[model samples]
Each structure stands twice: as structure tokens, then as C-alpha cells.
Target: SNRFSYSMNLKGASMTIDTACSSSLVCTHVSKLHLRYKDNEIMPASVVNGLNLMLFPGPFVGCCAAGMLSHEGRCFTFNSTADGYARGELCGALLFKAKQFNPADGGLCCLAGSQTNQDGRSASLTAPNGPAQEKCIAAVLKEVGLTPTEVDCIECHGTGTSLGDP
Candidate 1:
């Protein structure tokens, strides 16, 4: 209710989506489509934000989870050793609009698309399949006509589990 009135100004030109961990990423993908294919009709400037709060104490009983919070103590981003300390946080935010702002306004940091899928068999609500991981990578490559060798680094999901690592 806090931001609904503000959202009304966005109208049919805007959208609100919730995809848990991948929420912001999903928004970026859509914005890219709008920019590349629908720019003539839609001015593609957009603002994206995410927030994570680690409040469920019961979920980590007897677990030694470790993670770092943002300098302001608000998020746990890309920290290598991040554990259950990972919450639905202010994960990130982006301000972008197709053709609305020129790159020189501020250096243009290029945006790329991502593909996300479920493993289906969440055997323990955490376990993920290696084949699924491998396939997801392959699917992205096929869509973009690129190979793994061309990519530099990968931001991994460090849920403090070896199984989840793969």
C-alpha cells in the first residue's frame, strides 16, 4: 500500500513482478526485449530494485550459516562464503530506459539476458541436479550463439552446500 499510488502513474506502461531470487533479473530481460523490439512504441527507461531480509530463524536450526551484509547492513551480495545469511534483500537496483537516456549521461554498463529454470525434483528443497545446471548453461549459449570459452567469469550461487555448488 505504501507505493501503490506512486505505481498508478506508471499505468499500462509499467509492470510489477515477483520471481523471488530472480526477480530483478527477469525485469532486465523484459526491458531488453522492449528496447530491442518494441522501442518505437515503448520508451524503455525503467528502475529495478530488490530487497532481502533474513528473518526466518527456524529454517537454519543447527546450521552454521555465514554471510556478509551490505556496508549499510542491508544485503548479502556475491560474497563468496555467503550462507543462509542470504535473505530476500535489497539484492540490487538498476535505472534504465530504452533510448531515453544516452550512454554518455553516465557510462553505459551493458546489460545481458539470463535464462532461469527449475530442477523440478527439489529432493530436499535444496538439492539441484548437475545435468540441469549443465543444460541451463547450454541453453543460454544456444540462444545467444556463444560458447562457454567466450565467457569470462561466472557468479555462482553459494548456498553453503557442495551439491548446490554444481
Candidate 2:
């Protein structure tokens, strides 16, 4: 973000977020807040960017040693056959703007409402709680004045691991 700001001469907020796999998704939620409530008059559009780079073999070697990597080199998320998660490199970005100022062309999705939560109590630190996630999704739908039936599709992020199995 800092590099992009320097090169593009953009003077917006430049920060990094690290919430493991949910880093990019959290950025979308933060973007909505920034756009909906711009404290400054000069607030411009927000660009949420996520990057995953494998610069060295340390992480790969570690996950491999811990048996947290899929032998097939592919993710089998949510499947009983899932052995472990797959790792890859990617760089992506999304630009967000208020609807009124947003151009009609090349628009992706609207930012209505977004929410975030964590599993306070769990079997393990990394173990996922299905009910907690369901509640969070339901709350977001309610905030946006929509119901589960009304929503056609939803995007999800999965680590593709069988509970980060050992």
C-alpha cells in the first residue's frame, strides 16, 4: 500500500492487516467503514489489496514437516477426504467507492454491510466453530435488511485442511 501510494501519488491511509487467511476479507469490511464515514473531506476511494508470496522455503518446509500440506498439492476444503491445506502465491486488489461517485462501468459488488467475529472458546486455538460463523453471517444479513433465502450466493474462505491435521 505504501509503495502504491508513493508511486500513484495517492494520499490515502496506508496500512497493513494480518489476520492470517482472513486478511483480505477484513480489508473489505474496513473499507466499508472508511467509505461510509469519511472523517476528512478529501477522503478518496479505498483500494484493498492482498498479497501472498513465497519468498523462501521456510514456511513450506514447516507446514510440510507438520503434515499441514496436501500431498496432492490441491485443497479439499470441507470434504472428509481433506488431508491438509494447499499454499499458493497471489496478489489481488479491489477498489471501493461510494455508489454515487462510483462509475457504472466495471462495477463489481456493492458494499452494504460487513461484520467480523472470532470464536472466543473453541476446542483448539485454530479450530473452527460452525455456529459462530453462522451467527455472524446471519447478523450481517440482518444488518443489510436481508434474509438467508433472499441471498443467492456468498463468498467463503477455507484453509482446505482437515483441522490443520497432524
Tell me each candidate's TM-score. Answer: 0.61, 0.89
- Give the root-mean-square deviation of each candidate in angstroms: 5.8, 2.4
lDDT of 1 at 156: 58
lDDT of 1 by residue, 115-160 (tens): 6677786575556677887888788778778888988766555443
Task: Choose the strongest candidate by lDDT.
Answer: 2
Model 2, 25-72: lDDT tens digits are 898888878877885456657889999999999999999998888898
Clashing residue pairs in candidate 2 are none
Each prediction's whole-model lDDT (CA): 0.56, 0.82
Off by over 4 Å in 1: 1-16, 37-40, 53-91, 99-105
Candidate 2 backbone clash number: 0
